[model samples]
Target: MSQSAAVSPSIDLPENKSGPHTSRLGLITVVATFGGLLFGYDTGVINGALEPMKLDLGLNPAKEGFVVSILIFGAALGALIGGNLADRYGRKHNIMLLALVFMVGTLGCCLAPNWQMLGLFRFILGLAVGGASTTVPIYLAEVSPFEKRGSLVTRNEVMIVSGQFAAFIINAILFSVWGEHEVIWRYMLAVAVLPAIALFVGMMSMPESPRWLASKGRKQEAFEVLSQIRSPERAAAEMEEINALSTNGDSRPTSSWKDLTTPWIRRLIIIGIGVGVFQQLTGINSIMYYGTQLLQQAGFTSQGAIVANTLFGLASVVGICIGLMVMNKLDRRVMLLGGFVLTTLFHLLVGLSAYFLPESAAKPYVVLSLVIAFVFFMQGTIGPLAWLLLSEIFPLHVRSYAMGVCVFMLWITNATVAFVFPPIVSQFGIAPTFFLFAALGVLALIFIGTMVPETRGKTLEEFEDEFKAEYS
Candidate 1:
């Protein structure tokens, strides 16, 4: 930003805005975040449907894993393409397109006649999933006030886990009511359509990402968008700040992958990738994807396992709410460190309990409670914060590129965990599986202590200036 730009008034959101504006902001968040809901529901819905899908389709371990992971592979491709698309067309518009793909994917999954067909459709769905996971946070962060950005963007993460929980409950109910039915997996797959439509129509009425508009040099449109989310005092101030940042022809590059080979961009990409990969290695999603199996091993029946897994999702929502409360108050580094410590302890306890306990009925319940505690620690500490950092760590011109590259790693790591977790349990059993996760948890604690920076109370403009000074 220029000296004149730095002199512009800092934006301060209303401490006394009317409830209607708040509701509008909330509505925008909900619509944009539906992208995340579908992301969670589609991926998580499979956990329950897996057994039934496998039984119906006659799949073995390998094919079953394929059926589960094919979407992730498609998501990787989707992230790359979607990032470019969002950067080009506009965030809200791209999200609308993604919602359509999500709807079609759900329909395809519901109507798939065979495993091969299902894998193909899941891949299609993944494209939308991957797209939403990358675009939604960027959209939310760009639209939100710096003070509220972390919480706003993380709302998507909260919705994601909540959606997964909802899918689990809905699946469990459908399974019970329609027990002994062969096509029940079809119902499980179909549940995602309602939210997909909600996302599509909701996005249709929403504004484009404010930052994206600024990046595109549509200053007037960007200001109008800021108006909807901010008090008039703040909206005008943010418009000036955005204009200042865009002075050097927007500082938003439209470039090929080869352009990202610059040293600084490369380093930032690595940081983003670290942010993505580390979040997953913490093994939070293992609970989302395979918690039922883990609970069953600890000795719960099928019904009991589904009921127990819902607690993790509920804990995740609560944890994210707390996380949002403290997000701006705490540094990203503090949250990461504290989260690592808390999650590590939970993992250790989970492993120790299972290692010492016999196959008693109480063991499953104990493990379920531990899973709940683990999620509470995980979501409150690492889950919401990781994506927030990832969204902000890159330079302005390369933000989308850096995010897409990084989130690609995120989804891949997720796929690895989801794909290998079941086999790991079968081969080494639950004791070693949790132990391995616990050990990785320790490594994560060490990683956070040695690296990661504090980024709070800093605007994107301030962040760029600070990083430029540090690196120069």
Candidate 2:
């Protein structure tokens, strides 16, 4: 890609008129983001539920890690295949199937008779999570008008953090009410089933992605879907561009895996993978999945730790809201670069505090404050930006496959961190563990500064043309 491409100015498109069409688009976004909500709740409920689950399930540290990380391993597989499934079956159809999987997995986990059964169900749940992660953003991106794309696409990020926040609150409440009960974790896990059912029912009325329809030579069907969401004039105009791009030899959609061997496609894949991998390297999930334990290690009681961890979830929710408000006004690359710098600085501060601060009552508070700051910056910037970029950067022909491969690497990295964090933190201390993350953050910063391109203002077709012109 050209250096100038990294600094392209925003495009000015005609404003979308507000009407029933606008309301319909908003409704669709709400329905689709339930996938994100489930993703957040299922992953985060583990933070508080794990302690009681360990007691009830006779879990060792290794078993605890396996139970938590197995879902991520399943997610990796889901992401790997999800893209192709969406490409083959259609985005809306793929999502509906995933919702059923979510219900099954959640119920299975709720009724699991043993630790092994819980792990099996968790992995099953992960497949739904992974599929949703890859499919929902693409669905959002394709359906949204370019001007509102940033905020709309990032709404999934908002729902994701909100779900995490809900999990934390529910976990705290259930733990307080049933702290004596061995069955409390079952209730926490079962909450996910409600959203899964909502997503399935809600999507039944939702339209398929117009772009996916155009790709499959269903242009009339695509236009009807677009008309329901956009003004007739705007929908017609957008369809012309979609059709033109579809017919153009230079931008033809390629389904074969061999097309990935093309240079420009390979380059985008690399950048996409880098974005996904570095997002995980931020150690955000480690904090999300183990915040209670980390707080306990800092000297709080188990109850206090669980309560304190809710603050982390709250910070993520607030941060993503801030991210949504500013998303359209800022450059994607700048937000990512700044997020990395701030998160890395906080990682260093966290390590320093854990190492230099005395073992006093104030130490945990100080560390907690620093971690909150880190999550704030992370969720506000990198968290949403990573998914937004992945959704935008690929050419239409290869978007699903490329995103799948990228998100697959992402979940793999997440699973590695989730599985190893306990053992690493147990063997080493929090300070050393954070220091290692700080080191990884430096490398991630370098990658973002050098490789990430600007996708701030261009429509999907325009960006694809620019990339093809620059790199073909």
Candidate 3:
């Protein structure tokens, strides 16, 4: 079936405005971004909850890894189909479904009777995480003006880091007050439910993606939604571009799989896949997922490790804040290149510190400092940019589908790393693991330098034309 035919035509957008107002646009962005908040909170809660969960659930190392990594496993599947779901359903509608999934999964995990049940629930939560990862950026990208797209899409990234930061603070407070209590982990897991509810309520009134609206022949609805977010003049101009692109895409088969046979489409998808792979290969999620564990390995006590891990979360939030401020000014390609290079160096230094300070009392603090720096580099450059690029890189017709495929690979790679990370650390120690990541980072750098295109300051239609001319 044609991709366009797969979507429903009667989808409704948010309440329309008579004129453009920045406050209204901000409200749309804020509401849409609740998805990112939940994504970050669910994932980050695990960083501090794992040890307590392990003890309460009688989990051994292997089961601990499974429980922690299982969410990512589900995320891989969610991401694999998330783009198609967004295309088939409206972006806003799909996110609402994801919010429901988030609440159910969080409740299940919090009340899980055993380790197996916990794993099952975590996998369910992964679906929402993966779906939000695919859907939210595309939604934001479509609603935003071309000039402001980079910064606006990145607001979701900032919210993600902010959510992680919130999780860390909550983890620290709960652990401080109730150290080792069986219920502390449950509290951490349950906190995510609040945000899930927030997402569902907020998205209920949110507008559909104007691009998605245009794609399915709801041009007036698209224009009205666009008019709310953009100046009337700018809205009219962008609506014209969207109509032209929609008309052009109408000639091609809507099935993204069939479109892949075209050289440019294939090349674009391949590049998108590369970007997703490299983003995960940087080993950032491994650190985010298990920062406390790694700090303990570096010689910190359990309490100290959790507190120090908060630093990692803070660094990410700060880094992303800086990224938001400068994203419009920098070239996307350059930001990614610099991120890879800097992260590789940080990885090497971390490995070396582990080797040289294996017996030092200050080992944990030194390693912690270095890891926070690594996160800063990652969040400032690759973390936000990866999602931004994925949202913007694909042509209008297959943008969501292509993003889903790319983020699917991303989640799979993340799951693989998370699953094997414990064994790798147990067998070889933290030092060697950092070295391994450093090696992968070198490859990521090469891929970015050679394969990634600069997408800054261009309309989606402009990119579509460029890709068609170059590869089609």
Candidate 4:
């Protein structure tokens, strides 16, 4: 193959390979995914706990929002620092480090005495969430076979939603039994610590990312790691591919800022950012973050809305599973386009129904149906696809920094939407809130259709060749 051809190479794993280590990869996935679990629990715990949390903390709309959104801001900062840390310390080491942060953040939140303390702890929790979000998927993607990469990395998302569901159920049971006990929120926050411990313990047995090892000139170590996961013949071949790409590939860029100064790199970063923003702007988090309280305002009681909120989490989990099933069978660009278009329609219908209907018997179910549809479409399409694409795009040399910057923008946009959602619904009503999300959804569809390229079935090196073709 020509050098340019080698730049964007793809491979098929051997049809009849077996090993002691196949299950080992699955084990590693479970370990790394604890980050996702903690993220889900920490973020979603507030949904059910919000009512009691508010009354206990004396929260008004603005302070409540700040308390809710503080973690996202912490996540933004965490991504920035964690990306650099992973790049410097190695993926495995930083993952272990992040688990400790997760524990501290969770414990802090659980022990918080007031809203101010809660915000402070949640910010710390965001750091862990952001770190895991960036690191875990990349770790899984790097370690997984391309044939199985999409499905494996998406487990992180599945775990995330599952954690959310567990939180809702736990909160419901606790609330029902305890009925406004002084510290019910603590139980909700404290549950997250289990996942943190799992992440830390799991990392103790996991190997470092072989690719990261190779990037730093540890070829022998890379081959050793690869051999554990691949058949001997396959492992040897894989190493050759990595060696060719990393050693003879494009010279490593000195700074991430260079991607901004350079045209192709800049465009790729922009596309990645669009994916991140679109993923959030679909209003998925709106349901996850405020599903209970928002539904209560729409006419359900506190307990009723929370029980209803579980359905969104459940739908999202199921949708992403279907998405993982279709990943290798379909192109990512198609998923993004089709998902957003349907999501746009759903949001519009929900807004119109909520707007026109009296706060009668039918309106809450209608809004609930719309939220369910949005979550389902989001998970099956944009949810898993966005995360997979972000992990795949960008050159290996600049992947960490570029991903950090893009995800930073993603977190900020998420925080902005989350912060405004409660107040917006309070001021303008549910119909208008859904209407605004629908408008942004339309813009996102246009952006994805025009700007984002298809990345399915391509190798990382081959994707780089695309950079030269598109902007060279």
| Winner by TM-score | 2
Writing each residue's lDDT as its tens digit, candidate 3 over 403-450 gives 888899899989888777877987999889999999999999888887
Cα distance off (Å), candidate 1, residue 401: 2.0
The regions of model 2 sitting more than 4 angstroms off are 1-13, 250-254
Q: In lDDT terms, how accurate is model 3? A: 0.84
All candidates: TM-score = 0.93, 0.97, 0.94, 0.95
lDDT of 4: 0.82
Candidate 4: stretches off by over 4 Å: 1-16, 251-255
Q: Report the error of model 3 at residue 35, Å.
A: 0.7
Q: Which stretches of candidate 3 lie over 4 Å from their true place?
A: 1-20, 250-253
Error of 1 at 400 (Å): 2.0
lDDT leader: 2
lDDT of each: 0.80, 0.90, 0.84, 0.82
The true-versus-predicted C-alpha distance at residue 67 of model 1, in Å, is 0.4
Error of 2 at 359 (Å): 1.2
Candidate 4 per-residue C-alpha lDDT over 212-233 given as tens digits, one digit per residue, 9 for 90 to 100: 8888888899999988887788
- For model 3 the local lDDT of residue 259 reads 65
Candidate 4: deviation at residue 21, Å? 2.9
How big is the positional error of residue 51 in model 2, measured in Å on the Cα after superposition? 1.2
- Indicate the worst ten consecutive residues by lDDT in candidate 2: 3-12
